[model samples]
Target: MPDSAALVKQLMFTFDDLVELDPMSLGVLIRSCDTDMLVYALKGSKAPIRDMFIGQMSERAGAILRDSIETMGPVLARDVEQAKNNILQKAKNLAEAGAIVIQRGDNANSQVIY
Candidate 1:
């Protein structure tokens, strides 16, 4: 794993960050995220955010995700927290590597930056 503190500082996107994104961009980012983190995020999400990810994935993949969510059993709180952190870490790596771009704010003048 990379330096978590460095990662956090470098790319401080949170669930709030995801919420700030337009649906298309959010979907694309979710598509690139790790499976475990994706699942965890979806499970914790409400309808609108959940729909964003589902809309991005292929039908078959979306179906699989729905099934996984339905069938998932008990999970530890720590594990869930870790999974969210892992997703954030991945996002940080992607941003730092310039593999993805994130819009920093709601301003129309704000350009997308990696």
Candidate 2:
């Protein structure tokens, strides 16, 4: 396999010094994204990876993000295709759809919330 794991590791990030992930998560993403390297990177990360890679999409998404950023925005550039562009963004990215099952304060409940 030529150490696909190495490629996967090189593409990961760390949040709070923890590395956590399940196998199918990355595979599903890789399939759905049509082998798009950027999507794969973001989906495969131990942390919620993002556009912080500096136009960090697969060569594919990067090209797209770069064009849009240069043409129409500076602010938009930050999030044009960004996942965890900043710490807050990282937090947001880290939190997945099923990550939370309940809300506190407004409504007390049990949840993973990532």
Candidate 3:
């Protein structure tokens, strides 16, 4: 796995960066991401992105995710942030491994090659 510093330097999309993507592109990335990464990202992410991820999953998976988030008690801000970072890192790794493609947003000028 790449170091976090190098990962950040590479500047792939973090969860926060999802907001910049069009719905179709964002949905593709969400569906391609690892399940655990989706869980982690959902826990820390805001409503729109969270909804997008849940929407991409099956009914059962979506229900389970919703329940998990509901029953999950308070988590530290830093931990939540770390979870989001982990998702970003995992996506980067997957892209690097040629498991998936991480494309630029429709509005972006340049693509980040993993």
Which runs of model 1 end up more than 4 angstroms from their true locations?
A: 1-12, 21-28, 109-114
Ranking by lDDT: 3, 1, 2
Model with the higher TM-score, candidate 1 or 3: 1
Q: How close is candidate 3 to the true structure, as a TM-score?
A: 0.68
Q: Over the stretch 1-114, how does candidate 1's per-residue lDDT look in tens digits?
A: 579876655456565465666666556577677777777766776778677677778899888887887688877767766766776666656666766666776587765543
Candidate 3 lDDT over 1-114, as tens digits, reads 569877666564566665554456455566666666566667878888788777766799889888888778877788777778776766667667766556664535656545
Number of the top TM-score candidate? 1
Cα RMSD (angstroms) for every candidate in the order listed:
4.0, 15.4, 4.1
* Decoy 2 TM-score against native: 0.25
TM-score head-to-head 2 vs 3, winner: 3
lDDT score of residue 81 within candidate 1: 62
Candidates ranked by TM-score: 1, 3, 2
Q: What's the TM-score of each model vs. the native?
A: 0.69, 0.25, 0.68
lDDT of 3: 0.68
Instruction: Report the backbone clash tally of model 3.
Output: 0
